[model samples]
Structures are given as C-alpha cells and as structure tokens.
Target: SLLVTSGPPDSSLQIWQVVPEDSADVIKCVSAIATENCTGQPWAKIATISARAPWVLHGSRLNSVRITDVESRKNVYVAGSSSSQELSGLAFLDCDTLLLCCAEGQLCLADVRHPQILLEAAPIPS
Candidate 1:
C-alpha cells in the first residue's frame, strides 16, 4: 500500500492501493486516479500529515494544488517555489508542523494548520 504523488494538472496525487496476496513480490494496484501537473513524474518520497486532524498531502514539483482538510477545516496548498530547486523530502514533525527539504539544500518549515504561515530556514548546501 503506497500513497504516491502523481503528476499533471488533473490528479496531483494517487493512492497506489497495493493489495498483497500470498507472494511477497506480488503486489497489485487495486485502484488509481488520473494525473494533474509537474510532468507526471511519480515522486519517490511520501508522508502522511496529522494536524490535530488527519491530512492527506500529495503533489509533484511545480504543481499548484489545493487540499481541503475536512477535519481541521483548512485549505492547504503547495508552497510557492521561488527557486529552481524541487522538493526532495517531506515530513510531519508534529500535528501542526511540517518540514520540507528542497533539492537545492533549502529546508522549510510550515504550520500545516495555517497555510499562510511559513518559515524559510537556513539552506543546507548540497
């Protein structure tokens, strides 16, 4: 079972519903969505976000998306990328904090509960 980020402007994310049978290598995609943006490259890194409520965040590089967290009642979007670097990693530090690492060694922290509040931390040279 994998929640992978999809591409294009249609399906920004997809839950690679992997249903494993008896065989260890036998994995099946039970269901899948369409594409949305970002050249449709499946991102390798995936993570689940919990912000006082459960949130499903998924997307690829340069994909402007809007996710509605029904539990917390917040609209989350991909932070605008001012640089050429793409996102390399994503993690939820806590219920309200999210950490994003860019390919250009830029690390960012944001408040998941509030999309407008973000912090541009120090960059790590790659």
Candidate 2:
C-alpha cells in the first residue's frame, strides 16, 4: 500500500498495509495530499486498484486509462488500442465487464468487491 509519499527524495514515508498471499488480483487504494499553503488538508482516495497492463484488448496498445465512479455504475475506462506490440494499443471497454483478450484467451476483470483471479498473462497476438 503506497501512502503519503514525499518529494523527489521522499523523506516522509509510512507503511500502510501488507498485501496478503491469497489475493490474486488485488486493487490497492491510493490517496492524494494537499498543497503546502493548505493548513488543514485531507487525503482523498484518488484511483481504484489497477495492475500492470490493467487495460487489455486484442490487436491494440493502450494509450490512456481512467476510472469513473457514478451512481448508476462504476467503471474503469481505457483508450488507445491501435497497436499490437504497443502497451498503448487498446482503449477502455464500455464498463468493467468480461474482456475478450484473444481468440482463445479470456481475461475477466471481476467486480471490485469480488475480483476474478488472473492466472496468466495472455500473449499479445501478432
């Protein structure tokens, strides 16, 4: 868990929590700090949990990634899936539903509360 990071050298750092072993695909929480001028500042939860190659698509490279939380639905948004060997190929799907990574490869990003386990990384098709 990354909490309260300081400057370039980051003098002030604290240990938040330890990730367990059973967690296959665990999304960690991130908090943001206020500016120096703010006397009484509060840390806000910035983004939901995401991982390496979080946004995946067939025959594409991901250009951008964004997350949205609304009353109707909460989702993880991604964009720029136009390259195969590129990490910026694929864009975000409509919502956080079961993703079709390849012809025989199935990548399902389960719900935030009940996340699906990612056993392996699908090889980007040529």
Candidate 3:
C-alpha cells in the first residue's frame, strides 16, 4: 500500500510506502515528484504492485490523471492545468481505473492499464 500526499507547491502530488508499524525509524520508503501541473487539491489511491496511480489536482476546475504500475516509484500521472483552473476531489474505480470531478465541470475516467500507450488528450468542454 502507499500513502497519498498532496499540497506543498502550487500543484504537486506524491506517494510514499506505508512502513511496517514495528519500525522505529521514520525512513520514507518511496516518494514521487510531480512532473506535471496538478494545480489544486491532490488525490491518490492505493493498489497492488499491479495497481495504478490515480491522482487529481483541484482548484478552479478539476483535472486528473491515471498511471499504471509499469515502473515502481514512478509518478507518471497528472491532471489539470496549473493556471487559473483548480482541481479537487479524487477516487479510483479499481486498481487500474480512476475517477474525479474537476472544478471546470469535467468528469473523467482515466485508464492506467498501459503507460506506453498513447492516450487521447482533450479538454472537456465547460
């Protein structure tokens, strides 16, 4: 399982492993740097090693991204613009699926089945 983290920079997201409860050390197992703009509230989900990473950036509007577990400790998922629009609210349908509402009235479902596959990128009309 992973710990989802949001808020720090303007639009940032990250994840860390849930260390065993017995450990007295506070060492973080994993951390993800935001590659894209998540310009608002950040969302995260925990799946198996086969599970995907689904996150949301919320503010003026909602934007979200879905990423598969092709690589470990990689935050290859991002959603929304870092400009005036803000995103918030996040949920996952399954290990390979994600759901969220954008402030721009956009409802999205991203498939994290394959990271190498080219996905259709289009802004949902407000």
Candidate 3 structure quality by residue, lDDT tens digits, 1-126? 555555556544455665656655354737654434444434332223333233332222333344434235345554433333344554556755556554565555555555333233367565
lDDT of 1: 0.53
TM-score of each: 0.56, 0.19, 0.45
Residue 110 shift from truth in candidate 3, angstroms: 3.3
Whichever of 2 and 3 has more lDDT, that candidate is 3
Taking the candidates one at a time, how many backbone clashes does each contain? 9, 17, 13
CA lDDT, every model vs. true structure:
0.53, 0.29, 0.44
Maximum-lDDT candidate: 1
lDDT of 2 by residue, 1-126 (tens): 433232222221222334566856454434322212122222111222234322222212122122333221224343223322222122233434323232244342323223333223556688
Two-way TM-score contest, 1 vs 3, winner: 1
In TM-score terms, which candidate is top?
A: 1
lDDT of 2 at 105: 47
Candidate 1 residue-wise lDDT, 20-53, digit = tens? 6677555444434333344555453446665444
